[model samples]
Target: MGSILVVMENGTGGFVDSSKELIAKAKDIAKALGMSSVAIGFGSEAEKNLKGLSVDRVIAVSNPELTQYHPEAYEKALAQVLQKDQPFLTLVANTTMGMDLGAGLAARASLPLIAYCSQLSVEGQEVLATSSVFAGKLMAEIVVPESGAVISVMPGQWPQDTDRGDPPIDRMSLDLPSSMKILQLIEPEKGDVDITKAEILVSVGRGIDNPDNLPLAEELAEAIGGVLSCSRPVVDAGWLPKSRQVGKSGQTVKPKVYMAFGISGAPEHQQGMKDADLIIAVNTDENASMMDIAHYGSTVDMLDLMPALTERLRGE
Candidate 1:
């Protein structure tokens, strides 16, 4: 039986969404490969938050140097742990920190590394990874040509298993790299709607046609108390900021409510928001591909319906 180590970054707020998604996928890999799964993370107080997972073991390395991310220090301490554990495979989330540390870890450990992988599977004494190429236009399959493999998984690519039983804890203290220390932390200015946290999102698409029509979609989002997102085309045309774009080339969202306005539902656009719990597409074209998966839709053009709905909401 093989042993795989799952390295998670438990930061200030808590364990990131991507970490949980990785653990879920790790559990599947562990089961399929007949391997034991051990979860490791670093934080000032990270143990309590991760005690509820179904992992075989949870290791918390507590230190102030790890309070904020310092890539070299993380690599050193994590390398020590990995060398000691000698796990057959290691997995981590493909985030900013992951990107920073992935190459260094692979070099230090002399293992094959794969980053931003969309999926993972075990073959005969080999692990296969899938990733996108050509700006998401093509998918490439990667195989790790080593006995020990390091993989960094993309966010929202794996489904999280919230039903896993409580995970056991194994607390430990590791030597901190003296060179690492947190200096200052700066937070970004949050928007009116934190699109990342929004459970319900109503995204505007290419069909809106003009920037002047954005307010109408904003009104609809306001009515539903949801975040307003856009497809790549809208952002490319400067109708919306790049931060608001939702697609394969943009942000990946899994909101509870996904309302597509005039979106033609291209494969690229659908790739971003396919995980939405409930999808409602409103477009004049009744036969657009977006309508195929839409739970509720109207054949009327959004231009004609939006003003009337806004006025009705305002009691006009």
Candidate 2:
């Protein structure tokens, strides 16, 4: 059996949610393939962050320059590791950093790269993968034709590893080439109510009509004790923050209850919310695809129903 090398970002703190999910998927895939799985971390304090994983080993490329995430440094270090390990398959989380490094590695190494993979399985020498297409309206299965395949998986789509079995983390270090220089690091803005962890979500759409009309949606969300989210149009119209946008370009939410109001389900918007356990759509149009997929739906306008529902919910 060949070795499976899983790449971990090992961010400033511990591993990010996506990286943790990658480790979990790597372990599961490795077990299925009957091969050993190892997690490779590239950061200055990687050992402190990645030592908690249940993997067989944790390889660190700890250097001061490696602390901040830069495309050049990451590509150079990871490419060297890939060449050295020569594993059967390399797995990375489907995040901005992971995708960039995965693409760079694929180009430099001339390996088959599968990006944004939703599902993966091993079939003999082939690593079969499935990607959601047409805004997650369809599933397409594919196989990497190259010997050493590189795959980047989407976060929150896979579960994280919790169990710690035998064969504790074997810490190994790697020396990197001093060609690349570390530059300034810029921190991005943070979002409120990280939708990835929220079990309940109340999503609004164009049905609300105007920014002034959002009080009702807020009331519904308040009654339900969950944050209010919306479609791209609502966020684009300044009715809500971009963080609250739920779609392919926005956040992918897998909430326990995804209540959609006035939003005609577009493929791009639906893809992000399709994983919700129970979907409820409030739309007058009965023929809407949202109603078809929604476990519960109402034919009346959310505008008319909002006040009464809010009052009733408040009364109860």
Candidate 3:
């Protein structure tokens, strides 16, 4: 077994929180398996960010175009790196980018891919990956091969590794695709409260029914001093901003208390807020996925419960 390679997710000029999460997990696995952990990053942002990272070694593909996310270039670059190093386990964040890149890399490099990995451990030089299936209703365990495998770790499951050290930087380059270019990139608007930092979150899903009912959830949040969050459908419906959305495509949150109203708990949504201290899910369907993970679950109508909870909190 060689080293564990982590494909870090880069942001504007630094790594994202998920990037540190992968790094943190890589350290844990490497320590348990007696293997070194290597981090691979892209472009100038990564170059600046990778220097002080606490890893055995860092490989930075210092191409300017690689700063942002170029699917073609990234797949090709990572393919080349995999061919040369062949780490025992390569970890990538199961993000929007990782979902696409990991699949492509697995196909091109002929390596096994374990997606939606929530837990991993080493057993006699073999890595056992626990993956969530059927939107977290079931769990499947996968064993990595002797040759190697690619694993996309679910975000918010692991803690962020902030320990910094000067790691040796290995520079590299490749034939990046020139056909595709980003003409304009617009960032999503920020919300007032960062739900990730919120101690309590009142999360809504498609169960909220109509936009007019948003005030009901808002009232409940205000009464409890919690922030208002929603699932992907709410963001898509323009009922909430992207910053307020919690899921794989949205923000990952681990609040002290997570109150989910009308959310059916898709796997993506689970990845965002499943690690909360306490989960209270309210859905009409008793068999909803959220009910399985929630500490307290209710089959009562969300509309009816929202008002009652708010009125009780307000001492009405």
Candidate 4:
């Protein structure tokens, strides 16, 4: 039986959450296909982290040149692993590093590549993956025609794997070319507030109309003792900093209460804040995607609603 291979990612202290989520999905696919799940990671620290994963085996590829993430170096290392094992399915996170390496690895291995996969299933003998299209207005189901297919799974679509057991670790090495090197790692500016830990989030989107009206949302958030957050458009428009942005490309937040004002609820934005305990959305369009996931929704104009809501919350 062909094995399911998962490419693990390295984070500050351990593997990233997306990597574990892919492993969880890979385990499910492997079970249905009657195959074993194998995980390949880089670095000795990654080997220590992989010991807790539930995969059948963990291959840790270590090299001096791989101390940091270099796109070409990763592509070369992954290509060597894929060439040797030739697994039925290869899974990577649809993250910055994953997207960088996924296409190159697929082309190098001569396999089909699927990206932004939110769901995967085995239909008959073929593996089918579902991904969002058209700004998440539609979902497209893609079928991998043959084995050795590579897929980049989107984060937050599946629950993270919690099974903690020591998996057998296999050590390996790679000779990376000196031509590939990271010049520098420039980190983004740290925001004054960390929205990820906010108990309540009052977020805005394009529906707010203008950046000049941001104070209205800020007033409401302050009244409710909540942090001010926003969708990608708000950040893109420069009304809010990227730290305030909540979405797949921004921050994944799980606040106790998420109050969205004038947000259209695109899948990318929803993936970040969908796990909130209480979702309350206020949009003029009652049929907005935000309303679909909201526990309580109001079809009122946010321009009029924000001031009144702020006053009411302040009065209480």
Give the TM-score ranking, best first: 4, 3, 2, 1
Error of 4 at 44 (Å): 3.8
Q: What are the clash counts of all predictions, listed in order?
A: 0, 0, 0, 0
lDDT of 3 by residue, 1-316 (tens): 5799999887755888888999988989899888889999987777788998999999999888778788889988888888888888889988888999899999999999999898998888678999987877788998887888999888777789989889998999777788877566565555677888999999999999899999999999999999999999998999988899998777888999999999999889987888899999999999899998899999999999999999999999
Query: Considering summed lDDT, which 10 consecutive residues are worst modelled in model 3?
Result: 182-191
Q: Which digits, one per residue and each the tens of the lDDT, describe model 1 over residues 137-238?
A: 456898766577788777678777575556678777767666756678754334344576788787888889999989998897787678788888898898
Candidate 1 residue spans exceeding 4 A from truth: 11-13, 50-52, 163-172, 178-180, 193-274, 277-316
Q: Write out the backbone clash pairs for model 3.
A: none
Taken over the whole model, the C-alpha lDDT of each candidate is: 0.77, 0.77, 0.89, 0.86
Q: Worst 10-residue stretch by lDDT in candidate 2?
A: 165-174
Candidate 4 deviant stretches above 4 angstroms: 64-67, 164-170
Q: Once model 3 is optimally superposed onto the true structure by TM-score, how far is the C-alpha of residue 256 displaced, in angstroms?
A: 4.9
Cα lDDT of model 2 by residue, 1-316, tens digit: 5678888875656677777777787887778877778887766677666666788777777765676666776777677767877777888877767878899988887788877687888788567898755544456799866587898887677777777644345454545556666556544223766766777777888889989889988887888787788898998888788788887678888899998988888756775898799999999988676886799999898898877787888896
The positional error of residue 56 in candidate 3, measured at the CA in angstroms, is 2.7
- Cα RMSD (angstroms) for every candidate in the order listed: 5.8, 4.9, 2.9, 2.4
TM-score of 3: 0.86
TM-score for predicted model 1 compared with the true structure: 0.66
